[model samples]
Each structure stands twice: as C-alpha cells, then as structure tokens.
Target chain A: MRITQGAFSFLPDLTDEQISRQVQYCLGKGWAVNIEFTDDPHPRNNFWEMWGLPMFDLRDAAGVMMELNECRKVYGDRYIRMSAFDSSHGWESLRLSFIVNRPKDEPGFRLERHEVDGRNIRYTTTSYAVDRPEGQRYR
Target chain B: MDLDVVPMTGNVNLREELEAVGIEEILTQLDRELIGLKPVKTRIREIASLLLIERIRKRMGLTSEVPTLHMSFTGNPGTGKTTVALRIASILHRLGFVRRGQVVSVTRDELVGQYIGHTAPKTKEILKKAMGGVLFIDEAYYLHRPDNERDYGQEAIEILLQVMESQREDLVVILAGYGDRMEKFFGSNPGFRSRIAHHIDFPDYADDELLAIAELMLGDMNYRFSAAAREAFVRYITLRKAQPLFSNARSIRNALDRMRLRQASRLVADLDRVLSAEDIMSLEASDVLASRVFANGSSPANYG
Candidate 1:
C-alpha cells in the first residue's frame, strides 16, 4: 500500500544521510531542488504544495537539507517529497524525485477498477484520507 | 539517523521475484485474453524478461538508470494495437517502471494546434495528463506535415521529445500507426526512432484467426449463429477480406451488427408468431446473405 510515486519508495524512508546523498547527486547534475508536501498522495496528484520555491542557487546539499528541516517542522504530518528539475537543453522536466517525509499513520491507498468496454478495465487509486473532510485529514 | 544497508545479494531468487511482482500473471492474462498475435505476444514476453531481470537486480541492490520504455506499434487497423498498448502499460506498472498504468490515448489533432503558439500548450496539457502513465498517440505519423510550411506539429514534436527524455521514468509515450507510413515517419524523424526502445509489429490476423475472433465476439454477446449461418459467416469473412478498407476485427464486428439487424427484422416480420429464446438469439444464414457484399457478378456501389 506504499505510495510508489518516486525513487526509493520500494526500499525504505530515507535517513538524513541518504536524503542528503540523493540531494547531492541531483545537485551534482546541476538540477534545481525543491520540496513539496501534501496530505493527498493520490496517484495522479502531481503538484503538491511547494514548501518555499525551487532552490536554484544552493550548490551544497547541506544548505538544501537545512531548508528541508525547516519545512519538516512546519508540515511534519504530511507526505513531503524532494523533486529536482533539470532546465538544461533537451530536458526541461523533473530529473530526480523521491519522498523524504511521510505521515506517522500512513493510511495508504485503495485501487478502484471499473470494467470498461470489451475486456478493458480502468484503474484509479484514491487516498484513504479523502474519507475525512478537508483541513482535518491528518493530525 | 542511521540507515540499515543489508547484504542482500546472494539470497535473491528470480522465480520468487517474478511471483512477487506477478509478471507471469500479467503475461499469462495477456496471452489468454488476446488472440492471434503470437509474434507480438512473444516480443512482449521477451521485454517482460528483460524488465524482470532489472527488477531482480534492483532487489539485489544493483540499481541502475531506468531504461527507456517508449515504443512504436505498427500494423493495420483493428490489429489490437491499442489493446496491446494497454497490456504493456499494466506490465510496466507491475514491474515498478511507472507509478500508474493508465493509458491516455490521443491523436495528432489532440496534440497539434491550428494557430501559432497554440500547439505547445495543447501538447503540454496532454503530457501533463499522461504523466505517471502512458501517452498513446494513434496514427502518430500525422503529426508531421512535410508539405505544409507553417504546420504547428513540429512544436508539439519538440515538446514530446523533451518529455520523452526528461520524464521518461514517470511517463511513456507510444507512437502507433500503419507499418509503412510509420517507417516513413521514423525515417524523417530520427529523433523519435532513436528514443523508442521497442518497435512491435502487429501482423494482420489470418482468416482462421478472424473466424475465431468472430466466434469469440458472438459468444460474448450471448448470441450464436445457426448451423448454416456459421458457414455463411465464414463466407462473409472471405468476401469481406477482399473488399476495400477491410479492417480485420472491426469489419467483422460491423458485419455481425448488420446480421443482428437482419435477424431482428426477420423476427418482427412475423408479428403474431410465438417467440422462443432460441429464435431471439439465433442468426439465420439468410440474415448474413442479404448483405450487398454477397451480391456477385456486378460491382455493387455500397460493397462496404
């Protein structure tokens, strides 16, 4: 039931050293790192709430890690992911992304399958948090 | 914080990995549900094996860059290209290649634009919708307009190429069309051909395969042909194959629809007759023979 939207989801929630390693890897490739968090980790939910802005000038991973720590203090009950965008020629989208924070409860997702036309089954995954009203999904 | 890095190399088993990911189940279902694409099925199996090995390697802590999964499907109409694309999406999702397996099918019109500066946003919108899944472009060759000097398709193509490279781990784009025209398209657009990993050709179904498809379609509808009608349908298939625009399964489906209409007429023609379940479900040979396709000697205008 893990939200497998990014790298290292199949493994484990990364420690500080592992998170910094990934950030360093992205920074080494000249990618702009950004942090985002959301209570809804639905499969199609691409645009999570941005923590501040894309850190384009931060060359060191520790600086990004310090900013990440600040964001974690504010939204510790949400799923936060570190996404890096590469604006170089020929590739202008997210180059690297991985979840760096998750809720303590982590109530997971349920897949809904609809039988469409002949032998076609459409699948949709919805977060279990939607059962609660907005602004009160998590503690 | 300390992380646990286990020495997990020697304990990995490919068989257990395959079962854990249910790769075999997906392939088996692909074979069981689809008919007469033996070559396509085999190609899919090979790709599945490659992906399965990569998965096993990942379990053994040998992570590597995600391989490009973009593909091109070339074949005639009604050859199950879209169906196979759907199946491949499921395979990729199961193998942990993509986060979601939903297929967003589009064509040149959906991606291209009429006015200047409109194509990029149009294509980007579609790409955003297709992120985390597959973007299936049907008749993808139409995106290029060599004859037109001011076509917007080129802009769309550029955006597609960038996303195909940048967001490849999250999104897969599949270009589908007729074999020869697709070849010509790839010849002109080398960028597309270079990025695509697999080029699967869906062969036209043989007459026997088409017949099996016909029976399968009829069976699904809870309808059956009378003894003479079965032979009549076989003849219908032969005749239909010779006609122009002979789309394999699609033409057969249309033919069955017309026959069902004819059966309905035959039943309603007798207003007071007691109707049995067999009478309602059975299609007689006369119903199939009434089509303009069966008229011989002279060329009928509506032969379709």
Candidate 2:
C-alpha cells in the first residue's frame, strides 16, 4: 500500500487542474508555494528536496503550476509534493502540504524484524524501491 | 446579593472580583479539589505560569510564536488525570489562550473508525468539537495497536498529529493512560512524541490521601463515617490499593456507594423505631466492612 501521509491522502489524487486550484487558494492566502520531491516518503521526512526557493513573490497560480510541471518533468518517477508556507506571526511552518505526483509503480516498504532479547522484537521499515540505484528505482 | 439594588460603586468591586477569578484562582481551585498528586499539581502550575508569561510577552510585543500546549498525562485510572485536564482547559481559557474552557474526554473508540476511509473524518470531527478547548484522550495507548493488522487506530492517531500541529494555537490535546503503556505508545510514534510539550505523571494516591478523598466525597454528600468506620475505611482502601483494577479515587467512590447502600438497608431494618439525625447521616464500621466483603467476593478473615 502507498504510504498515504498528507493533507488530502484519503481523497483521490489531485490532477493538475485540481492542483492549480489549490495553488491559487494558497496564493490567495498570501502564502508562498514550494515544490518538493523525495524517494523516501517516510512520515517523519519533513525535509523534501526543494525544487527551488519558495515562490514568494510569484502571485499568480500559473507561475506555481509552471514550476510544479518543471519539477514533475525531472522527478516524475519520485513522489513530488507541493507545500504552502505561511510566514505570518505565530506560524512559520508549512500550513498545507499534499502529494502531487507518484512513481508509475510504487514499491512500498518492507518491514524488517529483528529478534532482540527474549520475546522482544525490533522492526525497521525500508522502502523496497530504494534497494535499487537512483535511476533504476521504480523502472 | 441583588445586583440591581447594589450601589454603583459596588460594581467596581464586582468587576475586581470577576477579574480576580482568573487562571491563578483556577489553579487554587484545582489544588483544593484534588487530594494529592503533588508533582502533578506543580507541573500544572508550571504550565499555567508559562502560558501566563507568554501572554505577557506577546502583549509587550516581545514574542511572536505561541507555545505548544499539547501534553501527556501518564498514570493509572482515577488518579485525577481527567480532572487536571479540565482544570488546564479553564486555566488556558482564563489566560486568554483558548476560546473555550471545556474538556472533551474520549477514548480510542471515539476517535478511530471501524473501516477504511472512515478514520480521518471521524477524527477530524472530534478535533473540530475540541477546538478552542482541551481534548482529553483517556487510555490513549489503545490508539496504537501494532499487533493488529486491521486496526485503524493508527490512522486516527495520524489525523490527530496533523490537527495537533495545525491547531496548536486554539486547541490543546492531552493524551493520558498508564505510565508503562504510555511510554510504549510514545516509543512507537516518534513524531507524536516530539510534539508533546508537557508530560505530567499522576502518581497513585497514598493510603491516607485516598481516605481523605473518601471523606471529602462523603462530606459533600452530607454524610460522615463513624470513628470505627474511619478505621475500617482505611483498611479497606489499603487492601484495595494493592489489588488489580484498583482505581484510587474511583475505588473509594465505589466503596462509598456500597457503604451508603449498606447504611440505608441497616436503617430501613429498624423502620418502626424513631431514628436520630446521626443514625441517618453516619456510616457504621459494619457498613464499611460489608462494602469490602462485597468488593473482594468474600469476608476478610483478618479484619475482625
């Protein structure tokens, strides 16, 4: 199963038009939109590689969509997401985040279990796609 | 007591009185109502002071970020965890933090949905109701069950984490359960662990504290224990404290309820005779002993 973790994971994946609407909503709130992509979709992986600096001065939704398209062209096989950052008082973190793209085939994680002492087990989750090299993953 | 009849100058004092009943007064009230758990009280006071100072700083334009109010209360059942969470809500409201000083107590069943595509909406609904107040999740460790592959509790927890972050300013989430189990629950969810700012441990009440709590409950109900009954209660609480399913203050409440039943039956047995006020209000030693026997499933051979 895909590790669905984000704002709108339970709903159907957003198309480019739906993504553009969300970007417009974020831009309407005076928030900066940024694109991010990563192979490791761990829930705690908060720092996804930034496609570029946050589109702070870009007020138009078309600007955000253009950048998002460029990011998808390069990292289309990886999980790409869009996040809106609110630099307002009392909140400096990402206010909204959602996955925009996923690999054609998502190879989910494998739960690695190790037996410790008596009746104790330690488990590690590793993404199966990451076992292959960067370009070969999700091929 | 009539506000209309009072002089205009009296309104000043009334306003002062209203202002006086703020966060500090709530803390004082919490201290008065709870019997023991000194450390728990102290931690709550610390949280109140921190929030108070933050408000002061924000007013002075010295700070911009609001402090996280999410907490974890680890202890056994009936050790005043829910009560403290309620008090925390009032404190936050009075201090101008949250809009409402209410506590919505829930367990795993209330947050987690039964099937797929149901957990997020259920959890979000609960969070929406808990906004501008405290969401007190009792036995929160049950929300994470790793052994059950079909359990949707983790989905509920994931929704909770997102809301806890997004709604930090208006809502406070208090996760409470047994100490060992809560520790294990935190161990499994590292993201959840990092978000919790305060961890208050409600230690089990000492024997004397339980007795005090029992007496307080009885007094509130216009009843008292006789001298011998007091001794009987102390013994009962001590024995029950060591047994399983012994929820400190809750056990006392149950025991008191049973004793009241026994006292009523005993009084009814002498229906023809005129009874004094003391006879009606006082619980006898036999009443306490009977409650103990009822709870333990047998007569205590050593109590006699």
Candidate 3:
C-alpha cells in the first residue's frame, strides 16, 4: 500500500511542474520552504535529515525547485518531503507538507497489538524497512 | 479560475472579477512602492485588463484562447526591472493566468554553458525549475553571439524557443537587458524576437528621482541626512551621473553606504565626546563630501 502520508500523495505522483506549482503555492503564502529526506519511514520521525538550509529568504519557487532537483539526484530512492513554515505570531509553525518523492517497493508498516489487563489493548506501529540498518533500509 | 463567485450569466461581470482578484490593490501598491514609472504602470494595467476580459469571455462560453504572456523588459541596471517583474508575476498569479506566479531570475551564465553538449541540460533544468511561473532572463541579449561560431548560447536559445512555444501555458519567459543591446538581439534573432509579445522599456531615473530614492533608502536604514547634507547629495548625484559606470539608483545606494561608513569613523575619532541620538542618526555634509567622486585627485586619505 502507498504510504499516503502527505497532502497530494493519494493522487498521482506530481510531475516536476506540479511540484513547482506546490512550491510556488508555499512561497506565495510567505512561508519558509524546506526539504527533507529519510530512509526511515517511521510515523513519529519528525527530524528527517534536511536536504539544505530552510529557504527563508527566497520568494521564488525556482530556487526551491532547483534545490529539490539536486536533492533528488542524490536521494532518489528515499522518501523526500517538502515542508513550509509560517512566521506569523498566530501560525508560527509548519503550515504545509507534502511528499514529493518516494522509494520503490514500500515495505508496509507492521502493527503489533498487546492485550493488557481487563481486556484493554495497546498497539505499536513499526516500519518493516527499519529491520535493515538506517541508511540501507530503503534500497 | 477563482471566478466561481461571479454568476454565470449572459453578461460579463468585469468589475466583480477585478475586485475579487484585487488587481487594483496590487497596482496601487506598485505605484506607492516605486518612485516614478507612469508608462510602465499603465502598460501593466492594460495587460491586467486584457487578461480580465479574456477570463470574462471564457466565462461567457467564448473560445478558449490563451494569450501568450512571454515579454521583454529592456532597461538600464537599477531601474526596477526585477521589482516590476515580481509584480507582474503576482498579477499573473492573481488573474489565474499562471499556476504559480513566482519569478525565477537567471542570467546568461546560468543558462549558457562553457563547453559543448552542456547548455541543453542546464537550460532544460532551469526550465523545469521555472515551470508554472515566470522565468526572468537578465541580460538576455548575451544569449546570442553572432561573432563567435563555437558559442553554445544558440543551443540554449533553440531549446528556450521550443519550450517557450510548447509550454506557453505553463510558464512565462521574460527577457531583460539594456535597451540598445536588446534591440540588437531582437534584430539578429527573429525567431526569438517573434515569440515576445510585450516589450516594456524601463527608463533611467532622473537626478531628483535618484535623490528621492536615496532619501527613501536612508529612511529605511534608520538614518537621516542633515539639511546641508541633502544639498551635498544633490551635487554628488550630478557628479556621479557624469562618472563612468553610474547605474541610476544603485549608485546612489552605494554612495550612501560609504557615507554611513565615513560617519562611523568620524564618530569614533572624537571618542571623548558623548554621542547623542541625533549624532548617531544624522548624516552630516562632511560625510557626504568625503566620497572619492568629490575629490579631484584619487588620494589615499580622501578614500575614507
């Protein structure tokens, strides 16, 4: 199954033009756009390795697209995502995020459940790919 | 098209679309932000109207005709070409013409390559990056070289032409350069010239306008010129205009930057005297006079 993790992941994989449009949308809203990638597809992995410095001073999507192209050249198999941060007082955090690239052969997550006292149960979600060492997990 | 609010009636509601997009607010902001460019602003308004009417016609079930938005911005440096291009991008986005209205600015070096078989990928990469927005090519004239047979700039141009025609809806390519050289470029390369629909020439700012720009810059930097210092700046403008390589408003900014440096040194020289807030903020006539342009000879001490 597809990870279905981001804004447009359910739809078709965005073409370069479509990705450029999304980047432009983020820049249009005056958000600080940044890119990240990781072989580990854990749901709680909030600190994926940043591709470059967060593009705060750029108003043009072309720069972000260029950097995205560069990042894809290296990390084509890893899951790469684009995120945007808004600096306004009320919304001083990430406003939008979308997975722009994904590795082939997505090893779906494994959900393990344990029955606790009084018929109560708890579940833990773990990524199958993480069985391999960190960097070698995806390929 | 963001025109869903407008009722789909037989008649066109031009005013509603204009208000919904807030084109007038962008135009007014353009006017207030830039110092003086009456004609440029008018042309932008005309383009906005053209796009607006095109949208209205489409809403009324007219033929779907996409007006090609490829344009040329010819002007001297520091004449607000980039600024105007950004505004045009915003306007294009607001009007629903382009998907994303950000400008990806590039120069000849960025597009053209040094050796054989390199220019195509470089140009294509840039085009991919600029997709769904404006691709602003500064000094676009440099892309054509009639004298050098081995030049790969023509390769870049050919690829650009193909994409400019094929991806007309997805991207807007804006060529910018000096007025005369751009004319020469258009003359030699008819294929390139024929693709451009709008040619906007940005004029050099007058001396008074440059002074106003300097004042505005100073204000933004939290510095103010003293009464006599303003008079000195007027003289400085006249002298700098006569000097070589004097870019209109850009040169004024450079001069003011140096003046600030001089003010810092002057303030530090008299360290014993307690400095007031006014002294920290105000630029004196001596600060303005200390430029290398004012001195008749290029002496080392006057460099301060």
The TM-score measured for candidate 2 stands at: 0.63
Model 2 C-alpha lDDT versus the unseen true structure = 0.80
lDDT of 2 by residue, B213-267 (tens): 9999999999999999999888887777666677788878987988899899999
Residue pairs with clashing backbones, model 1: none
Q: Which residue segments of model 3 deviate by more than 4 Å?
A: A1-139, B1-7, B297-304
lDDT of 3 by residue, A1-139 (tens): 5788768878999998889778878887888898999988887888899986677755557667767888999999899999999998999999999999999889989999999997999999988999998778777
Tens digit per residue, CA lDDT, model 2, A59-89 = 3465566567768888888899989999999
Ranking by TM-score: 3, 1, 2
Number of the top-ranking candidate, with DockQ as the measure: 3
Cα error, residue B49 of model 1, in Å, equals: 0.9
Off by over 4 Å in 2: A1-139, B1-21, B292-304
DockQ of each: 0.02, 0.02, 0.09
lDDT (CA) for every model shown?
Answer: 0.84, 0.80, 0.85
Please, what are the lDDT tens digits per residue for candidate 3 over residues B220-261? 999999999999999999988877777887878888999999
What is the overall TM-score of model 1 with all chains considered together? Answer: 0.68
How would you order the candidates by DockQ, starting with the best? 3, 1, 2
